[model samples]
Target: MNKKQETKYELILNAAFEQMKEKGFEKASISQIVKRAGVAQGTFYLYFDSKGAIVPAIAERILEEQLGLIKSEVKENDSIDRIIDVLIEQTFKLTDRNKEVIKFCYSGIAYYDSFQRWEDIYRPYYLWLEKKLEKAITTKEIAQRKSISHQAIFIIGLIEQSAENYFLTDEPKKDEELNLYKQDLYHFIKRAIS
Candidate 1:
């Protein structure tokens, strides 16, 4: 796609994201998204088939963004413990910032038939974590595991679920509480992998 098309596509996506975050997936309409994007309604069809179709795309985009951020923050020579620290910190911040969008994506994908694409959307992030786990095992930073893939998935689940619970729950946690939670979570993951 050319620059103009790419720009329009992102505009539509951004508009949809905003709409979904503000009004939720069920209530957010295509027309509203197109209007917010400043594109014709037909243009939305050019990119996405329906509102539900955008869920996976949005999920893919968010995952890609998170993966990029995490990769940028982590260095090649960093120890596994340091890597876990960065992962937890960055994931928490991102989850807190995009809690609404994350919720919308989860609910939207859950209700739609596009839920099958969920694994595909997360595959890159999963593979990245798997690679890290493999390296940690090679370097003796973590215990040798029969299934590095499962370890990666478990680590991701631990970090993401903990972050969501801390940030998205009904009761808000203070900064000190977040610090304690992160410390406990870090040790738990460390012991599990060690």
Candidate 2:
């Protein structure tokens, strides 16, 4: 896609994201998204076949943003503790900001066969974590795992689930409580990998 196409694509995506967040994947309509995007309905069809088709695209955009943040904030030479702290902090903030979109993408992807590309969308983020694990293992910073791939997935599952539970469910936490939770999570992950 060229620059204009990219802009229109993003507009449609942002519109879809807002609509999905507000009305959910089941209720958000293609008409609503296109109308909100100020684009022709045909324009949306040019980018996505159906409402469900947008899920992986949304997931890709969100994960790509998160990966960018991770790469910029977490240094290669950072110690394990620093790495954990940064990951937890950054993941929590991202989850807090985009919890609804995250929730929508998780559910929305399941209904579309094309969303099988979900794993492909997430592969880069997973590979980045895997590389971190490999480096840690080589430096004796974390225990050697039989499969670094599984280890990376486990770490991501833990962090994402915990963030969802903490930020997306129940009552909100105070700053001190949130800090304690982060500390406990950091220690839990540290011990598990060590």
Scored by lDDT, the top model is 1
Candidate 2 structure, TM-score to reference: 0.91
lDDT of 1 by residue, 1-194 (tens): 99999999999999999999999888999999999999999999999888988988888888888888899998988889998998899899989888989898888888677756998787788898888888999999888989999888899889999999898888956779999999999999999999
Tens-place lDDT per residue, model 2, 97-188, is: 99888888878887887555987887888898898889988899888889999988888879878988998886956889988998899999
Candidate 1 Cα misplacement greater than 4 A, ranges? none
In angstroms, give how far residue 171 of model 1 lies from its true place: 1.4
Instruction: Give candidate 2's error at residue 9 in angstroms.
Output: 1.4
Model 2, residue 126: displacement in angstroms? 1.1
TM-score of each: 0.94, 0.91
Superposed Cα deviation of residue 30, candidate 1 (Å): 0.8
